[model samples]
Target: MHRQSVAARARQALQSKPRASQHRKTRGRVALSNNHRAFRHELHYITRGGGRPVILVHGIAASHSEWGHLIPDLAACGYHVYAPDLPGHGNSPKPGDAQYYQVESLLVQLETWIESLNLQEPPLLIGHSLGGYLGLAYARDHSGEVRGLVLINPLYSPRQLSPVLNLMRKRPQLGEKALRATPKWVIQALVHLDPSAATQFSPQIRQQIAADYKRASPNIVYLTQSLPDMTASLPLVKAPTLVIWGEKDLSLNPASFPELVKLLPNAAGCPIAGCGHQPHLCKHQEVNRLVLEFMNSAAVAR
Candidate 1:
């Protein structure tokens, strides 16, 4: 009876071992191939159609979720929307050095990603805030690869944000310490200053965004260090560009858009009603309609 019981126990252990191994293999496969996989793997993105590629780039300290409401709406409108979290902001891996977060370095990664995906003839680049700057840079670096440009309250001449941005850059260690020490509630309180920011985001999203901002603050400071000189880069962006600005944006003044439009070789400025800096989030339907209309008009002309 003792031997029989021992044998039974041994068999159960053997079975459990293989089961565990098989379970691990299954999980590994899922992790490796998940649509949202990040890092050395192609930057994770979602696609819904087989049409012209529309790439959405989020601004500083934001993730793909910034474009969450906008992505599906655009995809439903028959666009192949590609929205990925820039490095360190979302699930993507961060480099050991913050210098990698600089605009020049980020642009290199963007180009590599375009080639990695083998985008055919320049994607329709739509960027918000800092992303607008990156999109402009991408169009400049790879002129023919871009079909058109859409700027959503983008950081054009950096002069507007220099005081805060320069302070962080000049004192990275102090800024990093202060950011790390900030309480989650404090971050949320700060966000509440945006007229409709809290209403637009769910509780869970607000927490996650606060965490993201704190984690990526150092990298964001580095990225915006040279933003004041960004205006000179505008002339290189010759694509048919559309600039959208919210009339009551506290984060970015509306006056900047008119000057930005004049700087671009071919650009149109549009004002969004009752919206703040994030029209895409606060006024999604209107934003989508305008973007679709602009894209459709450009498509017809081509």
Candidate 2:
């Protein structure tokens, strides 16, 4: 009953927004595949360009569209990029079951997505925030299958939460209800609290984000609830890795960057000055250069 009400409200809110046709067209095409047997749903992804494969994963409450700036840049540089909306976000089908939002479930879906594509070699994996956490987990379990990894402002553990979020973490049912009932403006305000996040997007991308949040709010809540300690997997990842962090990231503990670098035997760190959590979007040019450099170096090492 409550879920239905929330869905109804979201649909109403979505109806009030400008149609997708009003915005600039997306560069990538939406492709669907049913390669993952564990989940009985087709995976939706945006794939563009053709060359060395690069799989881009987005963070919580975001879709593949989050890579709007970096996708074309990567494709222009001779890399075939695949950015999936994950399971419960973007154009992908969202299941009502909370189990679908678990970190382990997302990792399995990623592995299956790769297998379905049947790449000649392990493609490079680049993830931001929760996506970064998922990428690390995938690299650790299937070390040889990944060419390299790039983590941009990755979240390894629970972020320092506010009183409301802390309460939400403790009482997930209440959190879900609250998130479902919250207005889009409220959510957007919270997201844009970090000035960098607000300045990173153009007006078009901002609209897309607002829509994504409306649909993926429940998934976001669940993901926050399932935040796990990623420290255990850090030592096990054998893939060449690059950890890029925003110098002024207010979301995750900045101190974790050095500690994360210390854990990975074959990893390097680069901090973007005067940036926040969404460095890939705001500081994309610098981020792209670092990504290209790291990928090129990894290829030479091989």
Candidate 3:
């Protein structure tokens, strides 16, 4: 009953072109409480479009701008979008304490954010990389609050993580020291050296990622310390899911998609041919079309 009502409301919203939200990007802050140490933190978000809500979560070292191309597209299709910079990334606060980086703590803070939005109906959650991990966790823990999930090259295993991140997860102090010691150019070289990123990312996309990443919190690596636990929570996610991946995503194991599909109770997936980590930007039209079709089919199913 509730699902159908929400759909009807969405349909009603589509009757008019949502002019106010069209192409206009609004950045703002909201006070959200983190479960870790009961700390209150301010979350920064970018919102665009209006209508049935769609939440976009970017990976570590990235922000809401990661969806620059997709945001306007979704808005034009009559879906309101909210893209947030998870703590320690983008414009959101970076806490000095390590506990705030725990996977559970991040998930709780995200849940609080959704609740505060008073979305009236569940919002579709879409995330990339660590963002995908957060979206998956949100769907798993608060199944009743999400309309569906779209995980793009999501983080699943510690093995899929970068060497520096993996090292950080193992030896916190050494990892911190290494992260601090690594030169900016060396870090870029390590990432770009990966064939996935080296061959695929357009110069424009690469530049954008580089600029956004430079501002990312140094302690951001700690966010993945609880990877195994989050990976274990996968089977518990009840929302219908669409797993999108880039076939050449060395950033996160490309082969992990099939395994992810198997673990999800109600899920489907697609791999973008010749694409790399940033499939949405790498192949915006195809990715956008897939998302539209998936949402349409999901609505019909509901």
Evaluate model 1: give its lDDT. 0.68
TM-score head-to-head 1 vs 2, winner: 2
What is candidate 1's lDDT per residue for 25-95, written digit by digit as tens?
11101121212222133344545555778889988888777787778877887777777767657666655
What clash count goes with each model? Answer: 1, 0, 0
Per-residue alpha-carbon lDDT of candidate 2 for residues 113-172, written as tens digits (9 for 90 to 100): 666675766689999988998898777766577899999988776644345655666677
The candidate with the higher lDDT, 1 or 3, is 3
Ranked by TM-score from best down, the candidates are 3, 2, 1
Rank by lDDT, descending?
3, 2, 1
Worst 10 residues of 1 by lDDT: 20-29
Off by over 4 Å in 3: 1-27, 34-38, 162-164, 181-191, 196-199, 299-302
Q: In order, what lDDT does every prediction score?
A: 0.68, 0.73, 0.74
What is the model-wide C-alpha lDDT for candidate 2? 0.73
Top lDDT prediction, candidate number: 3
Cα shift from native, residue 297, model 1 (Å): 0.9
